[model samples]
Each structure stands twice: as structure tokens, then as C-alpha cells.
Target chain A: DQQVKQNSPSLSVQEGRISILNCDYTNSMFDYFLWYKKYPAEGPTFLISISSIKDKNEDGRFTVFLNKSAKHLSLHIVPSQPGDSAVYFCAAIMTGGSEKLVFGKGTKLTVNP
Target chain B: GAGVSQSPRYKVAKRGQDVALRCDPISGHVSLFWYQQALGQGPEFLTYFQNEAQLDKSGLPSDRFFAERPEGSVSTLKIQRTQQEDSAVYLCASSLGQGGWGLRTEAFFGQGTRLTVV
Candidate 1:
């Protein structure tokens, strides 16, 4: 069963615009959420994350907002750049369990210059 | 040495063949995990190791799949009697702690080994 889901398969946006990627999860036990960006033939790199205690976390141009009541989260990138084009995956894990991260199908984001 | 390293970036094997994939995690990392990624799908966890002790391996698909970490440094994923459905990208990741310190140390991933069984 897919516990974490990214409904959008792909997204396109112009450069210098704000890009928003959404993710939803059904597992209420998940306490930590992370976003990863992957390029062709490369491993997925950690972008940002948020915990159940906090509703939001920001790093540089990336910001992750979590809504526990709705079981939804979003990754917002300001001034999207062409280099940011890649497959973005959202993952969740229970902090106390095995810590095995459950990942979404991923969303491909393209930034047109 | 500096990052998680997975060898044999690409591998092609015939049906019924056995293949072993290797992973070398960063020095001093205490947690190691293996994941399998299929085409157009996200990565799914396969197994996990903590200092040579395999704490979790519930995600292993079947009995033909086996993994080992002899010295707590390097790991190997062995698939016996490989099948076409076994083809996918196998990834290895490592973290500094065992999630005990409450530090959200992100796991670093290797490029991954793409396995194709024909």
C-alpha cells in the first residue's frame, strides 16, 4: 500500500517563479517528513524536512510546510531555476520505529528559462 | 571514502543468474539502509543494518534476496536465480546516528546500481 502519495506526476514553471510541490500521507504515526531532489543517474539528495512538532521548516530557497490536521505537506521553492529541474520525492518515517522511510512516487518539476 | 559508494553502476544478467551488488558507506556512520527503485516508482526500503546487526529486513521481497554486513562497514545484496522482475536500481544510504539523539541527520545516498535481468 502507498502510504505517502504525490498526486502530480509532473509540473512545469517559468524561471524566477515560485514552484510548489505537494504531498500527502495516510500514516498518522509518521513524525518526520523529508524532501529529496534527484537528477538523472544521480542519487536523491536531501533538500529539506519538517517534524511533527513544527509546522514548517525552511532552508535557503526551499521551504516545507506541514499540516498535521490534513496530513498534507508542500515544498515551496522561490525563484525557481533551471538547475532545479529534477524528480522531487517526499518521504515520511516514524521516529521511534525502524526509521524506514516511506516515499512517494515522485514529481518531476521542470523550470523553463 | 567521502560519500556512500555503490559499485558496478550498471549490471546485466541473464535469467537464473546470480548477482551480488556492493555498497561502501561513509566512515563512522552507524546506520545503513538498502532500497530498490523501479521504473516510474519511488524507492522502497529493502533492509537496514546497524553496526553489523541487521535490525530490519522486512522489506526484502523474497527468500532469494539476501544481504549481509560482515564488518559493519561494507554491505552486499545478493540475488539468487535472478528474474526479469528483479531488474531495478538498488540504492544504499548511510546516516550518522540511530535516531536516538533526536538529531535529524539526513541519510546520504549513493548513485545506485542499475540491474537488468534478461
Candidate 2:
């Protein structure tokens, strides 16, 4: 079973608009969430993360919102730029033990000029 | 400072051939991880090492996959008998910290080794 899930396979947004990517997890034990971005032929790079104690985290143009009640999280990028075109991955790690991160299938974000 | 570096950025192997991939993590990083990324998919956890100790091998698909971090530095991932299903990009990442905070620490990744099993 997929504990972490990214329902959207791809999203297209115009420049200067908001791009939203959503993810959900079934496991309640997961307390740490992360977002990573990957370009072609490259490893995924860390973008931002939020601990379970916080509901939202903002960094520059990127923001991640967590709703524990719904077991859902969403990343919002404002004024999406062309450089933001890449695959975004959602990950959750159960912090108490070996702390392996469970990842979603990923969502490809395309920003149009 | 140097990030994680992997050799033989790309590889091609026969169905039954054995292959080995190398990873040189950032200097002094205590935690190393191996992951596999299939086409149009996210990277999947494979194995993890803490310094020279193999703490987690549960994610490895089978016994054929072996990874080692001898001397607490450079590491290698070897596949005993390559299978077509093993065709994917293998990524290596490292973080600074012990097991307790390892998950919360940011992981710096290498460019990855792209393996194609024929």
C-alpha cells in the first residue's frame, strides 16, 4: 500500500499565478514532511519542510500547508516562474526509529511564459 | 565544499551481469543513503548507512543488492545479477548527523548513476 500519495501527475500554471500541488498520507505516525524538486538527469533537491507541530511553512515564493485532520498537504508557489518547471516530490518520515522517508510518485509542474 | 559525487554517470549492463556503482559522499557526512528512481517516478528508498554501519537494509529489493561503506567514507552499491527491472537511476545522498536527527537533517544528493540493464 502507498502510505504517501500525490494525486496529481502534472500541473500547468501561467507565469505570475499560483501553482498548487497536493499530497496525502494514510499513516498517522508520520510527523515530518518535506518537498523536493528534481530537474532532468539530476537528483531531487530539498526545497522546504515542516514538522507536524507546525501547520504551515513559507520560504520566499514557496509555501507548504499541512492539515493533520485531513491527512493532506499542499505546496503553493506564487508568481510561478519558468525556472520552477520540474518534478516535485512529497515525502514523509516517521521520526522515532530508523527514520526512512516515504515518497509519493511525484508531480510535474510546468510554468508557461 | 564538494557535494556528493558518483562515478560512471551512466551505465549499461547485460541481463545477467553483475555491476557495481560508486558514491563519494560529502566530506565527513555520517549518514549515507541509496535510492532508485524509475522513469516518471519518484526515488524509492533502497538502503541506508550510518558511518560504516549498515543500519537499514530492509528497503533493498533482494539479496542480490549489496551496499557497503567501509572505513566510514566512500561507499559502493553492487548488484549481484543485473535484471532488466533494475534499469533506473540510482541516487546517493548524505546528511550530517546521527540516526536520531538524520531524518530531519537535509540530505545532499549526488547526480546519480543511470543504469540500463539490457
Candidate 3:
């Protein structure tokens, strides 16, 4: 069974617009959520993360929001640029349980110039 | 190296051949992890090591899969009698701490080695 799910397989947005990617999880034990951006032929790079204790966390143009009650989370990028076009993976982990990360299928985001 | 390094960026092997993939984590990092990502799928955990000691390996897909980190600085993942279903990109990641602290410290990943079993 998949503990984490990214319902949308892809999303598109215009330059300078806001891009939102959503993810859901079935495991209540997951307390930490992370977003990683991956380019073709490269490994996923850490973007932003939000702890279950907080509803939101922001860094630069990237912001991550968590709704623990809904078992859902979202990553928002404002003024999205063409460089932001890539695959976005949502990952979850139990802070004190396992050291492994459970990832979603991923969403391919296209930002038009 | 400044980041995790995985050797043999790509590999192709016969269905029954054995193959070994290597990973070199960042200097002094105490934790290493291996993940397998199939086409159109997210990365799946394979195993984890903390300073030469494997703490978790429940994610290993089969008895054909094996991994070791004898020196704690480098790791190797070996597969015996490879099959077509084993084709995937194997990724290696490392963190600066031990145990679950590795995740908290944010593990850095390598470019990954793409393996194809024909």
C-alpha cells in the first residue's frame, strides 16, 4: 500500500504565476513532510519542509503548508519561473520511527515562459 | 567529494549476471542509504547503514539483493542473478548523523546509477 500519494500527475502555470502542488498521506505516524525538486538526469533536491506541529513554513519564493487534520499538504511557488519546471516529489517520514523516506509518484510541473 | 558520488552512471547486464553498484558519501558522513526508483515511480527504500552497521534492510526486494558498508565511508549494493524487473535507477544518499537523526539532518543524494537488466 502507498502511504503517500500525489494525486496530480502534472500541472502547468504561466510565468510569474503561482504554482501549487498537492500531496496526501494515509499514515498518521508521519510527522515530517518534505518537498524535493528534481531535474532530468539529476537527483531530487530539497526544497522546503513543514512539521506536523506547524500549519505553514515559508522560504523565499517557496512555501509549504500542512493540514494535519486532513492528512494533506501543499507546496506553493510564487512568481513561478521557467526554471521551476520539473518533477516535484512529496515525501514523508516518521521523525522518531524510521530513517527512510516514503515518496509519492511525483507531479511534473511546467512553467511557461 | 562535496556530494554523494555513485559510480558507473549507467550499466547494462544479462538477466542472470551479477552486478555491483558503488556509492561514496560525503566525507565524515555517518549515515548512508540506498533507494531504488523504477520508471514513472518515486524512489523506494532499499537499505540503510549507520557507520558501517546496517540498521534497516526490510526494504530489500529479494534475497538476490545485498548491500554492505564495511568501512562506513563507502557502500556497495550487489544483486545476484539479475532480472528484467530489477531495472531501475539506484540512488545513494548520505547524512551527517546517526540513526533517525540522519533524516532530520537532511540526506544528500547522488545522481544515481541507472541499471538495465536484459
**Model 2 stretches with alpha carbons more than 4 Å out:** B99-104
- State in Å the error of residue B7, model 1: 1.0
* TM-scores, all models, native as reference: 0.97, 0.97, 0.98
Model 2, span A3-82: residue lDDT tens: 99999999999999999999999999999899999998788899988889999999999999999999999999997999
List the pairs of residues colliding in candidate 2: none
Better of 1 and 2 by TM-score: 1
Number of colliding residue pairs in each model: 0, 0, 0
List model 1 lDDT by residue over B1-118, tens digit each. 9899999999999999999999999898888899999999999999999989999999999999999999998999999999999999999999888842134566899999999999
Expressed between 0 and 1, the share of native interface contacts present in candidate 1 is 0.73
Worst 10 residues of 1 chain B by lDDT: B97-106
Better candidate number, 1 or 2, judged by DockQ: 2
DockQ (Cα-based) per candidate?
A: 0.65, 0.67, 0.67
DockQ, candidate 3, comes to 0.67
- Give the C-alpha miss distance for residue A57 in model 1, angstroms: 1.0
